[model samples]
Target: MDLVLDAPERTRRIHRAAARFCAANGWAPLSEVPLPNGRRADILALLPDGSFRIIEVKSCARDFLTDRKWTEYRDFCDALLFAVDADFPQALLPEDVGLICAASMEDWALLRPPPAHPLAPARRRSMLLRYAMLAGLRASAAADPEAGLLARMALRLE
Candidate 1:
């Protein structure tokens, strides 16, 4: 029998694997990052070169097809990548974007590199500021469980 994972689980697996791969490559990966364009990036990473890269995870064909807004993400990052399972169809992905294939939790590869279009200096500065702020906030939250619980409870809608 073939094993299969639900969409959310598969997306999480791909995200984790992508983070592992990115870390090994000297990038700090942050998931569920909000971009200025109002789209949530699956994984926004701080590159060693002081730039940013966004990796979008597609759990299935429908997931990729339904959300074609991935292009808008390029305005906020130096490069864009699509991270998907090993069995995902390569043809469906845009040729200009980079590709990531995650075979296992700790095993993955960047099959292609996206052509770099450097972000404008001013835009980069603004995006970097927001990224640092978000990272610091997340770190503090993780360090303080009581505050985290309180924040979640307070933010929850009735």
Candidate 2:
């Protein structure tokens, strides 16, 4: 019998596996990262060598088919990948993007490696700064849930 999980649950499982995979490969994975083009990536991984990878999680065929912003993410990272459940039809995914299949949070396998295209120096610098700032903000929020509100108030007072 095939087990089916809801979209949100499947996405959460994919993220957990992606995080573990990134850590094992010497990358720090950040979730829900805002991109310059006003897009938010599901997972953005920063490598030790200053490069980055973006992973978009697709829970099912409908999710993948309905998304039109995936193409825009290529300009923001050195590599791009799609994370999906094992039951997803992999053949439907783009050939250019990498593929990862995960049955659950503890089980994930890379089906294909993404082709690397290094970002321009200027873009890399800007993205690195953004990544650092976002990471810092997230850490702060974790410590103090009201940090965002406090920061906004401080900005207004300035």
Candidate 3:
């Protein structure tokens, strides 16, 4: 039988499944936490030494395409892990980002470099931060372009 769920419900299931996985893996689950650079991440995790990592969870149909924001989420953290449903084809994910299948809270296969990723680590970090800032500005601009200009200026200063 095909069990169809709404988008929000699917996302909630994904989050819960990931939370269970984190707990099992000895990682502490944290709600929205501010990054060192002032950006807020969806989930912040603490390692044994107290280091941190960020996770961004997404839920879509088996054949659905990823939204553009996926790129922005990668920038705001040391590493990026995506929690997705198992039905989605893993091939759709980009190289360099970690992947976790949410149904069983299991670490799905990691996305490997198809033929070696060209961007250096430092360059990727910079790109992610810039993309995130632009994304935030774009959201603000949708409401009010003047506010977006101010937000963009403030982000640039930081």
Best candidate per lDDT, number?
1
Residue pair clashes in candidate 2: none
Error of 3 at 30 (Å): 1.2
Tell me the tens digit of each residue's lDDT in model 2 across 40-65: 89999999999999999888889988
lDDT (Cα, 0-100) at 108 in candidate 3: 39
Tell me the TM-score of model 3: 0.57
Per-residue CA lDDT of candidate 1, range 1-158, in tens? Answer: 96788888888899999999999999999888878777889898999788989999998899998998898999999999999998788899999999999877988999999889899999999878878777766776789967756654564310
lDDT of each: 0.87, 0.86, 0.61
Q: Which stretches of candidate 1 lie above 4 Å from their native place?
A: 145-158
Give per-candidate clash totals: 0, 0, 0
**TM-score of candidate 2 versus the correct structure, residues matched by position:** 0.90
Instruction: Kindly report which residue pairs in candidate 1 clash with one another.
Output: none
Q: Which ten residues in a row have the lowest lDDT in candidate 3?
A: 109-118
* Winner on TM-score (1 vs 3): 1
Q: Which of the two, 2 or 3, has more lDDT? A: 2
Q: Write the per-residue lDDT of candidate 3 for residues 56-132, one digit (tens) a residue.
A: 67776442363555455444445667777776676777667777777644553333311222345675566455545
Could you tell me the C-alpha RMSD of candidate 2 in Å?
3.0
Give the C-alpha miss distance for residue 94 in model 1, angstroms: 0.6
